[model samples]
Target chain A: MAKSTITFEDINVTVTVPAGTRVIEVSEKVGSGITYGCREGDCGTCIMKVTSGWNHLTEPSVLEDKILRENMAGKHNRLACQAQVLGGEISVHPV
Target chain B: MNKLELHDSDGKPKAVMLSERVHWVGSLDPDLRTFDIILKSANGTTYNAYVIRGSEGVAVVDTVKEGFADDFFSRLESVADYSEIKVIVLNHLEPDHTGALPELMKRAPQAQLYISQKAQSMLKALLKQDEMSYTPVLTGDRVSLGDRTLEFLHTPYLHWPDTQCTYLAEENILFSGDVFGCHYCDNRLFNDHVGDFRFSFEYYYAHIMRPFKDYVMRALDLIEPLPVTMIAPTHGPILRDRPDRYVRRYRQLSSPSLASEISCDQKTLLIFYISSYGNTRRMAEAVYAGAMQVPDVRVSLYDLEGGEVDPFVDLIEEADGLIFGTPTINGDAVKPIWDLLSSLTVINIKTKLGGVFGSYGWTGEGVPLVEDRLRGLKMRVPIPGLRVKLIPTDEEIQACHDFGLELAKELMGLRSQKVLNFADLA
Candidate 1:
């Protein structure tokens, strides 16, 4: 129902996505630079830090939480494929 | 356009400073392709080496590939004199790191070569130099370099049995060979500059370190308490800004969570047996009876003698618990048991309960050996292996049954399921 602005800090790119859009899909639409392998949460290829608007993203699944918790990624970090736009501006730094 | 110039003005390889006296002298294969003939290295790769200048003498941490000898030596010579290089520390004996070792040993003939105890025979066989003398180092072992101290951590199977991680006490830098490494090659040589190398790092782990996850966890735990400011791996960019991140990533990747994710709902138990004289087969039946005593657990028994009578492998993959019954032959488990164990390694057995039971004549080492192997595969062993000598007595058979019950209880505990006591149900 709402739009969220997703900014890719590394490439200085940004795109607008509807509520609950995955970060990987946003990156694909805007040609934002985000390297990924296996796209699934298991491989951890699309790990990215939410530089801002952490609360704007959707909740992480059990698998994503497990992997992120394992990698010692902070609350600000979320796998691009797993984290969705809940509805606000979110800035990301791919790790 | 290499940022470090680890090469002189005229393109001759040179050493670049990492901190003050610490230098990076490893060579880069910009055009090189694959790594270990398995993983694809699209960005090529780097054979990282380090030169630490202590107050008395210098120490070379590792070497580059053999084909890059000229470049490697040039870089080594650019920073310190070969004769002044007092120590050559080899964290691993893999060819990628030891390819230029023979030439390096020839150049720095007087330098002491340091390797792990497990590496002694492996290095000899790998280099084909049986008589070469090496100083064997172990976990917590230290070799002083006048002002700085190099401590060795015997972290085996970080990819190889002989692998070790070297820590520099003064700088608090850990020379972690292949432990936190990837095949990523770039002029930007630090995690801060490289942005995110998650894919390359994950790919490296999937290909190289997946089979030896247990060791990876052990190494992480072993190094967690150290005041490590930097991680200089044998490949890719060094982790300086946030070395802890990589360590945490390793812990996450190696966690049993990945293996346990297979998700089996039914409590399955596999009892496989090989009978030399029917004694072990009887033990298997006794254990199966005990396991069947517990409710809701699906039990599958397979005689591994003829091999193809049952789909033991398919059953093993689905089982939540495993029990092996074997006859000791010359103080060892039978060949089929060994073959089955080897095949099980390729399957995910983490978080599963495992036990060994066997019949022995002169030696009872077979069960214990199987237990050790199962433990090595990261299986949870809830009870000591049941070993019955010769023909099992009624008491011995009961003991095996009790062992099986204990294993079943442990499995229930692991899965956090309530055991259905027939008395309580009644």
Candidate 2:
């Protein structure tokens, strides 16, 4: 597994993540700054805004997109577990 | 929230907003703690009212609660200066929405109360009037205002047949009487304004609207293509936040997946029995009370004498849990307990969980008999059957609520087997 660097805009914290790690997983490794429930993505609690580095994230699941378009998802948001980190720099605004 | 800020679905500001002819001077029912068999978070329900500011003449849509006629009149006063109105549209003949009709008509002597054609005879029968200010407009009927128009879609059995929804094309707002309503009474109206929005919508959908599945589906299909930006129903907050989210939920409830979707966690049904002079009934209730504390499992209480075991049998046959209780008899089980156990054995119905309860004068008879019966039925008894000689102490009752929490986990392992609404099985 390869490690990648991740950053949060609100907390000004940086963390190293292994390859194939999801943004949601990276979110958990950092701390309780993020809120998520039903990790299955049914509940719309874990959405966040994508401030930058969206290209490094996996495509949003169908349910994720639906929540985002409804203005229910947080800023530039993507489901953390659903969106795997792809060995690149990423920036996110916690919602 | 600004009224003009409310936009049509096509991203246009509401160029035409209906006049405030009708006002919701309705009261909330404090006693209505649980409405339509579901617990309500909102303390009470409000009556929705609208006034039509027509180019020809003003029409008040509906009135509020019984005691709140003055407020409705005040709202109507703000909409139009005319003391005499032209038409008063009665979308639904239900009392809360129509309670103020007589007084409203008296105030507006020139106004005719409009109702559906199907509802025409029903209202006349209810009101017992031959020439009361009534106008019967059913389907394909149009009420035109110089600036705007109201088209009636007679929604049959969507709660009520007289229940018709009006569409304002120029403003693109659906004066949907009650079809898309919540029980909210907050001043902060609209979807986005209400935090924790999904629960209210689900409560309305699951309890109030779920029963009328077919009519709801037909109604949804009819409006799916319409350019609806805002939905003002007869109850709850106005859907100005994000109308699409509520609309999508309605669609999901109506979709075919409703039959197959297992929304609850995997759990077995828990049936508890309770009785008073019927001591066994107490045991049944205690067992049920116990199982309910458990999460993820469904609990049902059967009274050997009080409850009919036949109707709830499907819940029993498919459930992974079971409980029985009865009062003591001449050192023997009560007749109903014997009958129920015999019925279970005859049917060969079995489950993964089981328990028993009973009261006795000299000694307990029901609990032991119940255990023997369940064993004969080949039903699985995971926990030792509970026996109470006389009445249960406070600890005994605590045991019941606690029992529920434990079985909830056990039942969680059982899958929800379909008894109805399955195509292949059907």
For every model in order, the TM-score on chain A comes to 0.89, 0.80
Candidate 1: list runs displaced more than 4 Å.
Answer: A1-95, B258-426
Candidate 2 global CA lDDT score: 0.62
In the predicted model 1, the residue pairs found to clash are B7-B14
Segments in model 2 whose C-alpha atoms lie over 4 Å from true places:
A1-95, B1-41, B82-84, B258-426
Instruction: For candidate 1, write residues B318-358 as lDDT tens digits.
Output: 57788999888898888888887876543356546688899
Q: lDDT score, residue B353, model 1?
A: 68
Docking class of 2: incorrect
* Highest TM-score against the true fold, candidate: 1
- Give the clash total for candidate 2: 29
True lDDT of residue B225, candidate 1: 92
lDDT of 2 by residue, B1-426 (tens): 433322347643222233333233334443445554444755566577776666777767767666766655655564465464777787777777877887777777888777776676557655667787676775567787767677777776567666787777767777778788877665445456654546666777655566566788888877777788778788777776567777788888666441243444545565655455744555556566666665655566655455676645534545666766666667777676665555442122533456665667787766766765664454444444566667777777666555555555545642232121111211
State each model's CA lDDT, in order: 0.80, 0.62
